[model samples]
Target: MTAADLPEIKILIDATELFPSSMLGEMVQQFLSGNEAKEIWLVLTNPQSVGVAYVAPEKLTDGTFNLLLIAVHPKQQGKGSGTQLIAEVENRLKELGARILLVETSGLEGFELTRRFYLKNGYELEGRIRDFYQDGDDKVIFRKVLT
Candidate 1:
């Protein structure tokens, strides 16, 4: 996606309960200005509405890419959108010299579905960061090595 995509993508973000922050707006602006992936993939349902994945390059100790965020609308969940988004992200990352993709998710009880979704998308359980999310929430880190 390009700069033209942002104004509409903001609408999709607004329709969701998960992303109610104006920081996202700022992030997208920065992303468009070159702080993010060379290309963005979207499950676009309208001009300014979409489910998105914000990718960023990273040099892991092993050197790879990190999919910073893989977000879908609550209304757009359970329709293979997450899997599709991962596939696109991986493909784009590979094209950009990425050899692996690392992702992180919260392990809150309420996010069990989020955890499983990553596993289902071919990410392996790598490790965990205790209390990474808060007093009672740990962060689960997962990774998929691209071929």
Candidate 2:
């Protein structure tokens, strides 16, 4: 997504509960200096943005990327937008010669659907850190080798 799209995309982010809506501007601004594809960003524009994603190279690792955040508007949640986002991110990373993509999510009961989404998308259940987010909240990591 481009700088011009951030305002509208922020709505989607907020709707998806990905992060605090207040932080989007500060976060996206850091990646917006016009260097193309250094970070893989995408927004699904079905009339309006229904999804958004951000990916960055993992520090201290060669060709390893972190799918830092991805969210689809709640209204569009079951409409394949999320799958399309993942496919696009993978395709873009492959073109960039990336070797792997890692995604993390909370392992709370409320996020079981999210964990299943990753598995359905071919990500392996790689690791889990108990109480990483607080008591009874684990950090679940999923890995997809792009090769």
Off by over 4 Å in 2: 35-37
Please identify model 1 stretches exceeding 4 Å from their true place: 34-48, 59-62
Relative to the true structure, how large is the alpha-carbon lDDT of every model?
A: 0.72, 0.90
Let me know the TM-score candidate 2 reaches against the reference structure.
Answer: 0.95
Which candidate number maximizes lDDT? 2
Cα lDDT of model 1 by residue, 1-147, tens digit: 566766656666676555664667666675567755453544444333447787766743444766776677677778877777778888877777677788887888888998898888888999999998788789899999887
RMSD per model, one decimal? 2.6, 1.2
Q: Summing lDDT over every window of 10 consecutive residues in candidate 1, give the lowest-scoring window.
A: 39-48
Clashes (candidate 1)? 2
* Model 2 lDDT per residue over 39-109, tens place: 87788899898889899999899999999988999999978999999999999999999999999999999
Clashing pairs in 2: none
